[model samples]
Target: MRKNGSNGGRAKYQCAKCGYHGYLQPAAPAARYAQVEKLLAERNSQRSIVRATGVSRMTVANLAKKSAISQPTAAAPAAEISPAQALGST
Candidate 1:
């Protein structure tokens, strides 16, 4: 049992054990969610995104898939060589 105050007292929660006092604040759901969306847009790696986003990487992947955003594909490498070969024949 403890008294909590804004000044400098412990926040109190009842312990499941033999009756003890504990103090900690749970995270707000919305704040945690916004972090996730931001990270996905940044194209961060899954593990790094999890650390920064405060959400599971799997969630980020799902959002990315659902986002339906298309990225430009790299230029073809083989086509360049073929064009040079075409010019040499003439």
Candidate 2:
């Protein structure tokens, strides 16, 4: 197969023998993506995630941004008051 440029960031290949053309499969598998996500969820730094997962820094950063946007913000916990405060004694 010969290189036929890229489409949507994926490399396209053309078969020299049979005239077949197709995009190359992703280099990283789904499990690798999951592992990256897991590391991100654990609050690991993007650089650390890249080093640990062997994924590119850009990939980790993109995933982190995507995850950040998708997840909803958590509400802060309500503060507790002492019985005396509640009774307005102080």
Candidate 3:
């Protein structure tokens, strides 16, 4: 399955199993945001989280903001009024 290029450069390769082509670039740094978020939730400092997770401080901050935005928060429940207050006796 080896064939030389028409330009006389290096030969081209085609995979029969996966059909993958060209160079595959590495993923972005935010890929480890889960770990970063875990560390952030541990009350670790930004610098400490960066040091432990090897993620840039800026990226960590951005991911933290994104996580916060995605989370759903529950509203506080209303307090029960006393019977005296209800009867206007207070």
Candidate 4:
């Protein structure tokens, strides 16, 4: 592949043999995201997480929202009543 030109302010490359042209997408920062997730799990505030991890506020919020949606919340236990309580006899 060879550099063709700039596309959308990113370097565009073209296949040397096939004539296919496109911009190479950058890889996701997995390590940074892992750090963000760790800080989030530590109960750090979104702003604090952003400061600590150098990730954007929106990114932190999105990760938090995604994790919340993915994890299942435990159901609250139902209250039990004795026969006397059920009869309102205290």
Candidate 5:
């Protein structure tokens, strides 16, 4: 894939407390995006987000994995058939 400007992949960062080395990420190395996505997906209100995540609405909206598909709820099906169909009367 072609990259525009400086994409700058990964970088090494030193842990201040233990002097351990780790890789810093362009998004988030430890899967913070997954959390952001979960929050966004739950349709939680923006004010509630700030109260909980300490991030603004714009940030929450931006960080979400905007392209993922939402699965239909389990208790209800997208399509349903009559009980007679379930029997052998179709």
Candidate 6:
């Protein structure tokens, strides 16, 4: 297919399983996660992340947990892997 010369043209997609169709949305979970990681790496605060990325604070907190960010919690020590264990050795 050729471009329609429109500045805001987006590819339309169809789902065969559900018979769903829609234009592709640019912002996605993985993209948001990557952006969050980048911003977090820069030492940005949660509020800053939420404001800049338009992601909710709860979502940011969830992503932080999923990313295994170091947290000073009582359970944190339980999740640590010894050097030998990390190397898959006994």
Candidate 3 backbone collisions, by pair: none
Best by lDDT: 2
lDDT of candidates 1 onward, in order: 0.66, 0.90, 0.72, 0.89, 0.58, 0.76
Task: Identify the superior model by TM-score, candidate 4 or candidate 6.
Answer: 4
RMSD (Å) per prediction: 8.7, 7.6, 9.0, 8.8, 10.0, 12.8
Clashing pairs in 5: none
RMSD of 3: 9.0
Residue 88 lDDT in model 6?
95
Of 2 and 5, the candidate ahead on lDDT is 2
lDDT of 2 by residue, 8-66 (tens): 88889999999899987755667898999999999999999988878989989998999
Query: Candidate 1, residues 1-90: lDDT per residue as tens digits?
Result: 334333356466655655665577758867876676677677767688778757777777776676546645677676445766778974
Model 4 segments beyond 4 Å from truth? Answer: 1-28, 78-90
- Using Cα atoms with residue i matched to residue i, what is each candidate's TM-score against the true structure? 0.42, 0.53, 0.50, 0.54, 0.37, 0.46
Q: How does model 5 score by TM-score?
A: 0.37
Better of 4 and 6 by lDDT: 4
lDDT of 1: 0.66
Backbone clashes in model 1, listed as residue pairs: none
What stretches of model 1 exceed 4 Å from their correct place?
1-21, 69-90
Q: Candidate 3: where are CA atoms >4 Å away?
A: 1-31, 81-90
TM-score, model 4 to reference: 0.54
Clashes of 4: 0
Model 1, residue 40: what's the lDDT?
65
lDDT, candidate 4, at 19:
99
Q: Give the TM-score of candidate 1.
A: 0.42
What does the lDDT come to for candidate 6?
Answer: 0.76
